[model samples]
Target: MFPIIFVSLGPGEAELITLKGLKALQNADCIFCPETPARDGRLLSRAADIMLQLDIPADHIYRFSLPMSKQRMDALNAYDQVYAAALSLHHAGKRVAIVAEGDTGFYSSIHYIYEKLQAGGTPVEQIAGIPAFIAAGARGGLHIASQEERLTVIPGITTADEIEQLIQSRSTVVIMKLSQCTDEVHRCIRLHPEYDYHYFENVGTPQEKYICDTRQIEALHFPYFSLIIIRHNSF
Candidate 1:
């Protein structure tokens, strides 16, 4: 059986895919792409978009749905389905590629699929891509860190207390999946007004937006894939 590879499509733009990831997509016999839950009456699949932009043939691609719920059983069910589909394709002698929005291993659905494949003794490979926060930082001309500085990444679903403690630290903080807990995050940030903050939505896509002013954070409607980066002044 051919190996199952997980390819990162980068933040959003087709060109952001790593050279290795590009080559994997080009060489794969079949590609499995995630279909995200609808937002504002629209379903957006960054991996599928990238494949279309790369001119990958429709016949070579397959779509799999992943739930947006926080329940453990729901996540397991989704991963189980994805794993079965990919494994079947792999056993059929097709080199399968699972395309993810950002880096495959970072808070990505592909990670769960990877674990399933690994546990089943399936041969698997991963290609790294630029994560959302890094891409967002570059767009705003924000230096994430320098010598002796620290960087911390927290999921937006984390507790307000944890967010407060992390923000109080000297590390440059990047909060992923900010769409789910905007109110709590906004409250946490308001308490740390001394830090410089930037909110990124749809980083690298045509609809990409950045918020530099802290006041605007409460006013804007954040998308499902948004993130916030905070640079402590002391750092």
Candidate 2:
């Protein structure tokens, strides 16, 4: 039975892919990468770019246009579609690697397909990769958490009231899917003046940018790939 591998392409950099993930991509019979629709109608795939950066050429690469939607039904439908296609490829004796950006288990929609494949008793494997928040922390040379330090990850669509409560805790907080919560972000900005905000976008890629200026951070609308790390001033 051919195995379906879920390969995590850490952040956006090819170099950050673990040795195991690199090997998985190189040895796979085919790779399925999630691509986004560009403004020009061309498909843009970060996974494919990383694959090329690693000199891992492929002939049977599949680009599935996955929607970056906040709605659950829209995302589930896309994952189901991809899962069906991947299963078809796997049954054909192909080692299928469905690549996802960032850690597979960390706020990624790819896990939907992974769980679906697992429940169906299909042979599946997950290759871990560096999460975007971790890379952002590393990029700034800032330690996110220390011994006995509490670390909490706030998901994308958390309510503003919930976010306010999370920030009140004496812990390091990582907020992902920043694009979805514009109002919550503005609320957080207005409410929390004591915390330090580290904003990072397109981390690990050439387009990476991070800022500590709260005024600047509040001025711009956050993008889909953006993440905000919040830590108390004392920490």
Candidate 3:
């Protein structure tokens, strides 16, 4: 059977991809890359750029648009759609790699794909990658968690109340996929004035930006590459 390798491209930088991930990309019979729509309707996501930076052949690269909904039905539907394509490609004896940003299993669409594949008895191998929050902590000059502190990684689409509670807790929190609920996240931050927040968008990339203050974020829309780290003093 052909191997299904799920590769994480890390947070942003092409160099951040693990040596093992690089080898997988180099050997992949076919690669499915995730692409997002830019503000001008252009395509982005930087997988192609990373491949070029590594001098990998682009002949086997394929772009797959990932959906943003969290509904169970929606997730299952999208899974069915993407997995069917993956299944077909796999059956053709293709050693396929689905390149995801950050860790493949951490708050990624790859989980949905994994579930569907497991249900269908399809084999899979998940190759880990450096996560964005870890990169963010490094860029911000702060450790995410020490031995005594709790850590929480929350999706940005989580309810404001849920976020508020997490932020006010003693845990070191990493909030991801904040593009959809940037405003809500900001409001939650505002409510908890004691916490220090850092925002990083596309960390380790040329387009990377860091914001420390919530007021500075006046944009009506959040960048798809954004993540927020909330640190409490008690922790």
TM-score each candidate.
0.92, 0.93, 0.84
Which pairs clash in model 2? none
Write model 3 residue lDDT over 1-235, tens digit each, in one string.
9668888888888899999999999998888876656668788758777877888777888876655455667556655677888889999988888888789898776677877787788998888989998998899888888887888987777766786677566777788887878778767767776677788888989878888876775443677778888877666
CA lDDT, every model vs. true structure? 0.84, 0.86, 0.79
What does candidate 1 score on TM?
Answer: 0.92
Candidate 1, pairs of clashing residues: none
Better of 1 and 3 by TM-score: 1
Worst 10 residues of 3 by lDDT: 66-75
Give the clash total for candidate 2.
Answer: 0
Model 3 clashing residue pairs (backbone):
none
Each candidate structure's count of clashing pairs: 0, 0, 0
Candidates' RMSD to native: 1.9, 1.7, 2.8
lDDT of 1: 0.84
Cα error of candidate 2 at position 162, Å: 3.0
lDDT per residue as tens, model 2, 76-148:
8878889998999888888889888898887777899999999999999999999999999999888899988
